[model samples]
Target: MRSSTRFERDAFGPVEIAADRYWGAQTQRALGVFDIGEERFPSCLIHAFGLQKMAAARANLRCGALDPVLAEPVVAAASELRDGRFDAHFPLTIWQTGSGTQTNMNANEVIANRANEMLGQPLGSKFPVHPNDHVNASQSSNDSFPTVMHLVTVLELEERLKPSLVLLQESLRERANAFANVLKIARTHLMDAVPMTMGQAFDTFARQVAHGFDRIDATMPRLLSLPQGGTAAGTGLNAPPGFDVFFCEEIRALTGRNFSPNPSKFEGMAAHDALVEVSGALNVIATSLIKMANDLRWLGSGPRCGLGELKIPDDGLTSSIMPGKRNPTIAEVLAQACMQVVGNHATITMANASGNFELNVAKPVLIANLLQSIRVLADASRVFAQRLVQDVEVNGAQLARNVENALLLVTALNPILGYDKVAQITAAALEQGVTPRAAALSLGLLDEATYDRVVDARTLAGRPGHRPEGFSERS
Candidate 1:
């Protein structure tokens, strides 16, 4: 029978590796040492590393640091890695060496072994495609890991998160148009305040999402600045001259992104302020999402006892014992997702702050948290738009009822009756448990004709003749 494990040696010593695995000795050691968490780096991150390695190989070849013979197989192996052919080989958790050196070496070893196998050599034979000398040529984990972080951040934001935000913004705008004339009672500090249209509320949400897109767009320039050629420190000691420029050119070719070398590699390697800034943007988005979700939950509170101004979609989720309990499951889920993003931002903030003198050792955790925030926020935003926003039914009867009975509508009488008199009318309405109109008449505040003329809810919603800009007049 064939052996299940084989021996491979690194700078430290020999270690046993699975015979079928592409990773070598160092990866085997990391698998044993950093067994702390189940949080392996996501497939997107691994794929990004593949792209990074492939770009490095092409850059090295362009700079004449690697011969064409070795470069060919290395490029092929790294491309395969980027394309996810060797996904199972990368098994290290995010809790590994904070510099992500082990993960970098994992990529190196995997690509080197695969390249060697392609060259008709055995797995452990590091002959032509040495992991460090060729596969990791002119690159350091400190620089390469941060470069991959930036690459993945840009790709995730542009490809996933921004599109999702656009979808949500458009969805909200559509809802705003649909409800343009549906006047409802507005609340401040959870108490009835005045009148507004449901369209105005949804338009506010759409504007918030549009601003989220702008924030991410503003963050992209910083994210696109890479530090790949700064090798071990920010000095570019062993890297060939112009390697940074060539590496960026190769990266642009691979990703079609405008990746450029950071002017100050030291800042890129030592501080993750750019990533923290992105996280702060995400934090703001999470806050906005939480606000919108909470608003929906409150607006959809109950069909009989609560606010009941908005009808949440029935996604078939139910309580175990309740016969027909329909919960605001989508909004609740979206709120929970945003809450997790908030927590992830906290972790990312702390991790970014932990950077010391030369290099940030918290790279793995920082990138992991940032990627998780982007992924979950993107997915939740899309789901919230498609599943909830598109299907939510406005409770028009309840909205009209609330608007008609709201005591705060007395503000419309303030111009003629004055603030103090309006306050008395509101107080009397509350204390006597009557409508504001009834209380105003009881107090002889004004004639019913003037009150009715001024307190029209539709007119009180906004400026005269305002109809949500792009919406048509109510039929």
Candidate 2:
């Protein structure tokens, strides 16, 4: 029988690798040593490594640091890797070296071995395509991994998260238009405060999401700046001069993004402040989502006993033991997702502070948390828009009843009558369990004609024709 494993040698010694696997000795060594976590790098990050390796090879070839013969197969293999042809070849966890050096070498070994195989050589042969000498030419994990970090971040944000946010914002705008005339009682500090249209509340949510879009836009310029040619210690080391420009140019050409090299490579590798800024923005978004979600859950609390202002969508899956109970399942899910993002931002902030003098040793955890936040937030935003926000119905009868019974409707009387008088009326209404209009008349605070004219909920909700900027009411 054929042997199941074959021997591959690196600087340390020879190690046995699976016969069909493409990764070489260093990756196998990492597998043996850092077997702590099951959290392997995601496919997007692995694909980013593929693009980085490909861009590096092209840059090295342009800078005369690599031979054309070797560049050919390296580029081909790297393109395949970028397209996810060899996803299984990468098996290292995020618990490895802080610089992600082992994962970088994993990419190099897989690309180099694949390139060698394409040239009719065995997998372990460090022949024409050496993993370090050629495949990783003019690059170091310190610089390259951070470059990959920025690339994946920008791609995920622009391609996934931002679009989902836009969808949610538009969905909220639609809801605002749909409920623009439906006046409801507003609460502040968990007490009845005043009257507001449901449209105004949803419009506020839309504006919050719009601000989230602006925050993400503010981070783009810094995130697009890469530090590829910094190499091991931000010294450029063995990398050729002008390699940074060439690498970014090749990356732009390959990915069609306007990526440029950072003026200070040391800052890029040593401080992940840009990523921290992104996490801060994500944290703000998480807080906003939590506010909206909690408000929704409160408004949609119950059909019989709770606020009953909103009718949450029923997905045919009610509470396990309580039959026919419609819970705010989507809002709860979204709030939980936002909570995780908030926790992720805290982790990212702490990880970013772990940056030392020349290199941040917490890169793997940092990027992992960042990407996880982006992905989950994006998915949650989409689900919130499609599953919950779009299907929510207004409890018009309940809203009317609440608005009629609200003691805070006496707020509209404050401008006409004195504040103390309005407070007395409100207190009497609460004490007698009577409507504010009845309380005002019974307390002789105002005549019935004046109270009816002043305490109208619709007029008290604020001016009509109020909509978020750039939003038009749909017919």
Candidate 3:
């Protein structure tokens, strides 16, 4: 090959970096801008992405698209990145480059650049393993990005979210068991109206969370499907034949994950339904989280001015100016975190629908949003279980007091004292500011022995005990 005289000379001088640890000016600038408060792009996501590329390269090699020597370094570099040894190579700022193109190029250059250094080749030289031709062989961001997204979502859901969700359900179940013996007033419209056990309320929450977990489980198979060997377009035109099948199989082996090739190349690269589906799964989770957290806030509301059934950890300062003040900050944070996930889902929903025939221009936003929902939900669920569910105490004394004072418990009397007499007793108790028991006794609705036995919280909450043959509990 002859050197091209048409090659532009003076393409500008070499770039300089002031920071010793940073990779490039673009990466450094990115680091400054998208500092939206996350400490780092999670190492798990990075590892999954690197492993994905390795799988693609290995597949390409098996198909005989590249020389063995070139494939060796590509595999080696990808393996290092997967194992977290090449952190500096992954230096693109989260905000730096749109389409994640800069970040993808950064990975290629760093891997190739490092491999060359190992081979005693001059830096910036692209020989033996060109970054684009060899390291990135038979793959493009078009396929690799979504493939990695699916892989990461599946990994996180299986490894992190599922276990924590089980624990959350168990926490609620335990609370339900503990509260089963405590009879309480069930309220509707914020007004007490009937008799129910605290156990039933807690049990309902546990069941709802379990349903959310089911939704996540249902969404996993779609996420495990990858689009990797499709290359620049969905046609797989640039990818060697057999590349897709081999890549999927190798990934399943390397990562111990069951991934399959997407059946429709055109569908895979044409749009990102996999991402949307997973996002929808996560949104379901966020919806559950919001419901659980809000219920906790309401149930734990007040010692003097609120429901005050359960206690929440005092993690925030309610008032800077007032002394001895605490707030339900953990629950508040959980709610806000769920809200953020909901917002991310909205963005993903829009992005998924916004794509053109060949590709969606909104990929960067899609990836960012998908990642945000995964991480936030994972962390928030763990925190909620540990801080709010596990550590908080139940105000059993308050529960008893509320149950005792509630006129609504008198509804149980309707079944025993007859509806008309029960109504009279409730009205009298309210007017006189006296106990329902006292009112019932005064009204001659029932004899003292019968009223005491049947109206007690234990009997009312349980199987609504049998009355002697002569007297009916149902009147």
TM-score winner among the candidates? 2
Please rank every candidate by lDDT, starting with the best. 2, 1, 3
- Write candidate 3's Cα lDDT for 1-475 as tens digits: 5322111111343443432231333343455656655434466667876787688778988999878777777778788878888675565545533345556655666567566766776445556667777777888877777677678778887778777777777777777777776666777887876666777777766777777777777776777778877777788868898999999999999979889999876676668887888888788878878887887788888767888888787765668797877778888888898899999999998988877777766666777788878777877877887777776667888887877777866777777667888889889999999888889888877888887777776666664322123321110
TM-score of 3: 0.85
Q: lDDT per model, in order?
A: 0.90, 0.91, 0.73
Model 2 per-residue lDDT tens digits across residues 1-475: 9889999989999999999999999999999999797998789999998899999999999999999999999999999999999999989889989999999999999999999999999989989899999999999999999999999999999889998998899899889889999998889889888999999999889888988988988998999999888999898999999999999999999889999999999999998999999999999999999999999999998888999899988866787898887888888889999999999998999999998899999999999999999999999999999999998889999999988898888888878888998889989999999998988899887688888888888898886438646753321
Residue 349 deviation, candidate 2, in Å? 1.2
lDDT of 1 at 335: 92
Better of 1 and 2 by TM-score: 2
Span of ten consecutive residues with least summed lDDT in model 1: 466-475
Against the hidden true structure, what lDDT does model 3 obtain? 0.73
> In terms of lDDT, which candidate is stronger, 1 or 2?
2
Report the C-alpha displacement of residue 102, candidate 2, in angstroms: 0.5
TM-score of structure candidate 2: 0.97
Could you estimate the TM-score for every candidate?
A: 0.96, 0.97, 0.85
